[model samples]
Target: MSEPGLPPFESIIAGLTARPLARCVVVAPHSVEAIAAVAQVVAEGAVLDLTGDRARIKNLLAEAEVDVSAVRIHDSGDSDTAVDRAVDLIRTGDAEFVVKGSIPTADLLGGLLRQRLPGRSACASHIYVMQLEQFGGRTVLLTDAGVNIEPDLATKAAIVENALQLYSVLSSARPRLAVLSAIEKVSTRIPATLDAAELRLMAERGKLGAVDVDGPMPLDAALFPESAVNKNLAGEVAGQADILLAPDLNSGNLLAKALVGHHAPAMGVVLGAGVPVALPSRGDTVATRRHSFYLASHLTRSAATSPNGCDRE
Candidate 1:
């Protein structure tokens, strides 16, 4: 049976299997784990283009029993060139998304940003879909944990907008966004609270689309009904937020790490770009990476079909 309040894992896998192959480009595909990730997705009908050292990639493919005929191999010789080639494919609409391999995140993102795909947002951000057992199988969306150091009000607005887009694709219900801050009250000393107030107003004014956004709420009040009552917080988003908009990268990163460290199942993707970027950490398990692939594929398909392009459900 499917978990309450969350889609079943088997259903997600089945959805992925039903879709047509998503064209993917892997940059710096040199490590054994990277090769295995690519192979796993390829078996699911994703057409892959592995760019990196020619001899090394070919040798790894041979060892993994990945058929050379099934994938396109691009010999870029180095990480920099490999990233460039992958970005070029994205620019030309030949690839739906790019997967990070053995290359540094800076290198891969740098190349992608330089190309500046047409549909790219002003700022790119990361969002993690986390399923914590402690949360009673609820999936929480957390943002800007992997990117954006310390965003200002305007940047935070964009981050929320980007996350809302992804949330719309994943869930059928209207998203309730809790803009997280240290406290629930807007104070002059706390810039995050001020920003949260502005964001809430923006959503109320219909500037941020269809999400029910509330802000200046603490984490506990945002996720726990009892805490919300104890704090005397009264809002639709309190204790029922589908998304958590973090105050900054440090807070967001720490929250996500704490959940994962406690063995919560999580997957993440990069948004605000022309294509969804599957960005699993280097230390992530193969299962995590594969799930990220499925997430990206679903986002890609959903975005393509949306008339307003990820901005509407």
Candidate 2:
């Protein structure tokens, strides 16, 4: 049976209505597409333009009926510089978050890591995109597909941690994790299965925290209780995962792409930084971009307010 009480994306936003406004400093505010999206977010009380462009910048300020002089226009040469400035603003509490605009993902993250923004959580930090899978009234989070290439066991653990941190903000309890692989049993040759075993042991030993971690499960068994029962899988997380951790980037990318290709409603973001970063692709629909911005804002507002940065919750 499908889970009950699974809320839609809009309902999640509505639930957060009582939270304070989310303030963000965008890296590039001039790209017509980006600016338009930012404008909509600003209108919704979520972002502030921080790009150094004067002409388009002035127009946005004017459109908002805010004084141009009140905003600072830094003559940063590249998106990296703008990202650096934005991260600084976030760290100093001048802004609550940062957004990637007209910049390569590398540049944004390069500046962020080099600048030691938000107290530098860990060098092994990773990114995760959450897909809300509605089944039997339940929402399942499938992640690490939009970010992270091929990751080793340690990196996989970190990626799972990063995703779970976001789940904590979105839900009331800890999440159940399914480490995906081609089969349900470990073998000597398949590295994913071996890693899955280790990850499950890590969870059992409390190294992976309160999250329930199970792995080496086929995708079918990961999402459908009937499949789990058919396979005689004996665990709560086997077919009822709150978070689906992909084995590698190729799998993750393909899975997310397949969902979108099939017309599944989804939103994505880069997590594990000091704050949530909206890194939507240029090819995404305006609605997807806007929804990503909303997800990022939700993550930023609920992110822990400590300098240590890494979140175990």
Candidate 3:
């Protein structure tokens, strides 16, 4: 029998409606996309605490006739200070999570990393949660695609740990991790394969948290049951991985786009910071923004279920 993990993305979105959340979002509203994304968040019933260009945001919302009853505006002046203002909200207990509005991802994340937030990890990694039909509607994760560029072995381990923490919150079963590589053989010719080998050993030694790790595997083996069977691979995570740990950013980014190219059924968030962070792309649709915020808010709803005790009210 398959292990119990997160429900399908459809069910997750439905659950948000079934169990409404009470959360506050601190956003840097500068671009048109930011306002559009924040509209979806407010539609989800979250209180929006706008942190940039207070007057401009108010005027835009008024012109668009967006319901501002639940919106709160704060004057931060510019994107740089807006990030600071958002951090201040997190520090003062005014907001629970940070949403990437119009702020550049590098600036926002860099600013956040400088803060000494509670429960912060050495490395902050991004996890993309997707429901793959090839995996029987199972919710799977692809990690560090949007954050780390060229993570070393130690950084890859931190990324895996972050993914594991998030997995624990969303599932009842122990996470089955597949460390992705070019091939299944551990050869020094390929550095990713070596990292995969180390990660597997670390998991066996209880160094990578409560999860089953298998790696040095190709993508075909990671997501295809037939490939696992044909190759005679009998490990626990051969074709039933809950999280697919990418070797580096280039491969991770390409893999995610390939898997989710035709549709938009993925939810993304950053872990390892003091709180869950949603950094949805500016080009993403409003629905994507809604689901991303919902994903972050869902993590915040229960402290017992949050990764590394990372969620804060």
Candidate 4:
């Protein structure tokens, strides 16, 4: 039976089974939740962890039926050294992904992005959270609330790219993106509205990939067909939006929370790196955490099986 008010984690896991797990280097392996997750994945493929509690880890491995040799458990006698070693693995290509364990987020991210990590061209990375909701009969992309602060136009563009890439990978379709604002019209007084107009043009000129872009939409017009029609917005994407590009973190975060607060199912992943990264929060329930792992795992596997982020168009 499915869990009450939450989507079955298996639904996401079943989708992920098509792809192999992304190799990860977990910092502070002493974390119970991290160890359990790693143990489950290690049965199929190995992951590296910086943990000195070898005996506990060993027991978890045995119970999970994972090969003892499949995982490389590193002992970081001190907290300072653990971060150093974890970062080293990413720099040396020993691990493709990093999972934050007992360590704080700031510490984990700081180490992962240490001056030496490759593919770092100031690409302006952000997290795109996709919730599988039956919202007016479609799935939509919501983002940046889980990452980024007050992003400017350039950073917003990059966030769009990240979301588009994931949509292309998962939905196998060119997402119709609505760059959201408080109102449908561009206004110089509102910075977000002005940026929305710019993004729309970027999409039209084919600079933002193969996607239909419309913008400066109010929240109602972006999500509901009647609202778009009532406002006389003339565009296929107006009502059938596949992605909603939030102006910034505050709006995006609030929207995501509202969805979950009303019992919507969500799965989020961090993108634009060499590999898929899972950044589930501690406050997130186990179901949310597992779903995120499914997203990262599936995306990694899909990328491996087919290049170009899974969109042939």
Clashing pairs for model 2 are: 2-136, 3-136, 3-137
Q: For this target, which candidate reaches the highest TM-score against the unseen true structure?
A: 3
In model 3, the worst 10-residue window by lDDT is 304-313
lDDT of 2 by residue, 1-313 (tens): 4342225555665664445447767776656666666656555555364765666666766665544433465546566667767866776787766667787776676666555555333322334343444444356666676555667777677777667767777776657788888899898888889989999999999997779898889887887788889878877786677788888778887776765664356666676566777777666766667776767777775553222222221
Model 1 agreement with the true structure over 1-313: per-residue lDDT tens digits: 1223335444555565567657888888788888888888777666788889989999999999986777898889878899888877887788888788888766776667666666777567789888766665567789978878788877787888778778777666778889998999999999989999999999999988898889799988888878888888887788777789998889998988887784467888887666788888876777888888878877776442111222111
| Winner of 1 and 3 under lDDT | 1
With a 3 Å backbone cut-off (N, CA, C), the pairs that clash in candidate 3 are: none
Q: Cα lDDT of all candidates, in order?
A: 0.78, 0.66, 0.76, 0.63
Error of 2 at 25 (Å): 1.1
TM-score versus the correct structure, for each prediction:
0.89, 0.83, 0.90, 0.78
Q: What is the number of backbone collisions in each predicted candidate, taken in the order shown?
A: 0, 3, 0, 0
Candidate 1, which ten residues in sequence have the lowest lDDT sum? 304-313
TM-score: model 3 vs. ground truth: 0.90
lDDT of 2 at 46: 52
The per-residue C-alpha lDDT of model 1 at residue 146 equals: 80
Better of 2 and 3 by lDDT: 3
The full ranking of all candidates by TM-score, starting with the best, is: 3, 1, 2, 4
Q: Is candidate 3 or candidate 4 better by TM-score?
A: 3
